[model samples]
Target: MTDITASPAGYDIHNPSITEADNLLGQYIPIHYHFQMLEDQARMTGFKAALNYLLADGGKVLDMGAGTGVLSFLAAQKATKVYSVERQADLVECANALLTENGCGDKVELVQGDARQYLPPEPVDVVVCEMLHSALLREKQLEVIESFKQRYREKFGGTLPIFIPNASILAVEPVSADFCFQGYHAPIAFFEDPGSLSTRYLSMGETKPYAILEYQADNAIELSFDGLLSINENGCFNALRFITKNILAMNLEQGSTIDWMNMNLILPIKHPIDAKAGDQFQVRFKYDAGGEISSLINAIEVIKA
Candidate 1:
């Protein structure tokens, strides 16, 4: 139950102009992620989970950060219409094409603009933006969606459709040779400038209950990052934490704070004794706000090759 604010406090994206976020995240997003996001199924989960809350007649929804408009098409199934907004250039093309292929193009609209900058053509009952990342570090989840929510209210008086983020903590033994800095680095302990380090965030880990803070809003620039350490059976290290906060509807405005949540992997990394290959280990995980999570069992059982 560590306060993420104590881990690695960063910046509020809402306070900064769109141009600022463009400088900080624009390049990294497309280069490091957006393409994979279009092809990966993980991005679709939030949208699918969102379907459960969709109103049978909620008309004209907005899918902010609609990487491939998957959520938009999905929402179109339940609602009368949907607008999928994506900031990345090529992604808009992909989402547009996907909409057509899915046969929902008639009801789904695609826009290649920042969700924070654009408003729906008409007022929407639901504003779906799954810009969330592991432990709320890697994406502009809080800011963009909040901004859209504000716009939604200004244009029409209605609550935003920000569903629950519902997140928790998972502690596990590192999985691969890459996760083991001590054993992999072996005789040489110093790093050669974080090269080839896995940028992967948020993986299914052991289950345990933790009291981590949750945040959501209609508009604001809120973003942050944090890293924790862990060890494998042969002694390795890696980051271990993710976000799960519930986002209710909002009419919030500018100047909100994005508290960065961080979890430090203490057991395997800190223990004085080195774990040998094939050692049996258990990673305990916990979550808050009645959220459900499933993680890789081998994550807690780090076996040396």
Candidate 2:
């Protein structure tokens, strides 16, 4: 894991005063975003698998940012009751129709309100939310989950509801990604079209895990890490690749992993480094922990070991 430190001032784009009311993505964007997310088969399948395992005993469940209520419908199979909350009214309407069509209206309750302020009649056994982005950047997943945890703790005493995707770990690695750009390398804007980012790597180095986030944890400003990378054989390293590992569920003897279709965030190093076999170098980086789409700003340093 990389050493974490306070981020420098002026990078506070992600509102620190985030609330449930903050989920105002308006009308059209919500539908489009929902469609894009649903298209990710791996992500949808992972959630389904986790929901089935967690709700096997027919407990009460809450799905935050429920989007089209797909997860809520899935949870309805095993959960005795399910509450699906979404900020957009239009989505709630669509979800309602789908619920009726799928014969799940009886098992699930649809709430058209912010998850932050919306409260269920009783405490739930599990809370599921999927508001995540690559590297945990520019998304309200952390804030939303934290708010729910605090609210649940305040109202129900020490007991905490089970959280789907108990935790996520962000990892970085040095890679030869010159094909991504012409002259100077830069961070790819996945917000536009993630398909633009390809997984072609000329050469890659060992991964260094950083920024391990427990959804219930407090907000953080920045993440910093110091490490040494050994050049096994001569190679050119030009970019830092970021990947997220999400622990969606637990208790299975075999454990579990989700192939969520998340595009890796590739940040091009200012200058490329060429090293010979057995050569080593010290790598240090600091990343802003902002929750906005443009929060991919950071500083990195590499020196001979």
Candidate 3:
């Protein structure tokens, strides 16, 4: 086993130069991004199935941050009425056209406004908001849900609507990965899609859950984790892998859960720790739920034991 006192200087594991955080903060996302999101079959399939199950009894639904109105349309299939709120003007226009083309304009109402501030004229039975990002970073999913909950309580004075993708579990694991591609070495934080062939997990440490997010309940914006990870393999611990499991819906009778695609985030560490099977490490990390990845990079700390 080897002990590491501190992370090496000059290595920015979070990659401050990356503009994804900035891009996500913009008022309106580009169309190309929406196209990519629409192409995600796993994400679409999970949400559609969840909504179909939830709205089968015929209820009203509020779709916040409804990009392209896909979820709204799905909800309109069984929902008596659907309110789709979107802040982006372009997407709103696109959604309006889509609503007309689909011939469900009477059932789905498209409203242009900020999802965090928008409210339905009457109470809704279900709420669908999909502003998800890896590790809940660079997106306002938590903020929007919290805001809606507070406003709903003040207005309706009762239980809030059922939220789609009601909970999320965040986990982390230490890993060894190759950061070089075709002789170019850029060891930066990146997202590995499910079934990706790039990164290799180190079997030395177990993947540990650090955070749990429940949408309907009040949650802390800032999250911190301090724990010891036992290393069981002799290998290079060069990066930390963050995984988010989105629980879209659960059926108590059947004991089944519908989940969206898992987001795998790989963030390289400044220094690689070479350790034996019996080594251990005290790992500490903290980040805001809707904050940029750069802030998370600055808050990570690990001490060898």
Candidate 4:
């Protein structure tokens, strides 16, 4: 919980209680977000590759919740027109300055407002949003994109905008990390969990596709994993590592991996389970729809594969 009275950083971007008016004034703004985004080469390169293919013919683009206008600038290189929407005043100002510095101020239009309600002057052929987090948590990627997609359909009457990440899926794997609870740099008490420091440990197992979210799909999202994992080696499983596999663009048949596609969410299991090679276990993974930071894990039974 955050103290509402004190104005520390300015605004809580994640907290929904803050009104739109306050958000425009730069309350609780994350000062280092844009810096971090700029530093992420994998993230930037992935979008660049996607935009290079999508905007080859000089189409129009709408960058919802555009932070620092990086994606907008990338699209503006080839697109006929680009609209960058951002609600935070500080970010909007910073992005505007960056656009000018990059010599793209004339090409891209910066819009300062909530993207959900904001509409472009003309229909856009493509929409780009990079609000994704590990396991789709702490960000409104789905909600914002879904709203834009819905509003675009209603306004354009069946015309659809191309989503940057056409689809994304979540994967998980059981692992045995004995020293995961302790600090790798040094031993620290703050990093210790109640039952995480176990002496017994085992190697990790094969990963599985646990949950999936098709951003362009109209169907309700299903985020649950109930399946059996084959135990290749005898080891103690104590944690589940979640991975986000995103399809940044379609028709790219390259075998090379995207650097930004590697963000793993590691959650400790309630209890460590000992297992042997050739043994199969009924593993189940689920999390609160509202909060995906932590998840509930279950291993019903271990049987011979």
Q: Write the per-residue lDDT of candidate 4 for residues 1-305, one digit (tens) a residue.
A: 22223343343457554466634322334646666778777788888988887665689998987877889999998888998888876677677877888888898999888876887888988888777777665456776777777888788877787878777777766666554445453211112121243333333677789766666777343357778877777777666666777778777686543324536655566666787777676776555322436333333223334
User: Which RMSD does model 2 reach against the true structure?
Assistant: 9.4
Worst window of 10 by summed lDDT in candidate 3: 2-11
Tell me, by lDDT, which candidate is best.
3
- Models ranked on TM-score: 3, 2, 4, 1
Best by TM-score: 3
Ranking by lDDT: 3, 2, 4, 1
Tens-digit lDDT string for candidate 3 (246-278): 989989999999998566888887788887777
Shift of residue 264 alpha carbon in model 4, Å: 0.7
- TM-score, per-candidate, Cα-based: 0.52, 0.78, 0.88, 0.77
RMSD of each: 13.9, 9.4, 10.6, 7.2
Model 2 score (lDDT): 0.69
Candidate 2 C-alpha lDDT tens digits along 173-240: 76666454666645454321233455555435567787777765665646667888666556777667
Worst 10 residues of 4 by lDDT: 186-195
How much is 84 displaced in model 3, in angstroms?
A: 1.0
- The pairs that clash in candidate 3 are none
| Number of backbone-clashing residue pairs for each candidate, in the order shown | 27, 5, 0, 4
Better of 3 and 4 by TM-score: 3
Per-residue C-alpha lDDT of model 1 across residues 193-249, encoded as one tens digit per residue: 111233332222333333333333332232222222333245333323332433322
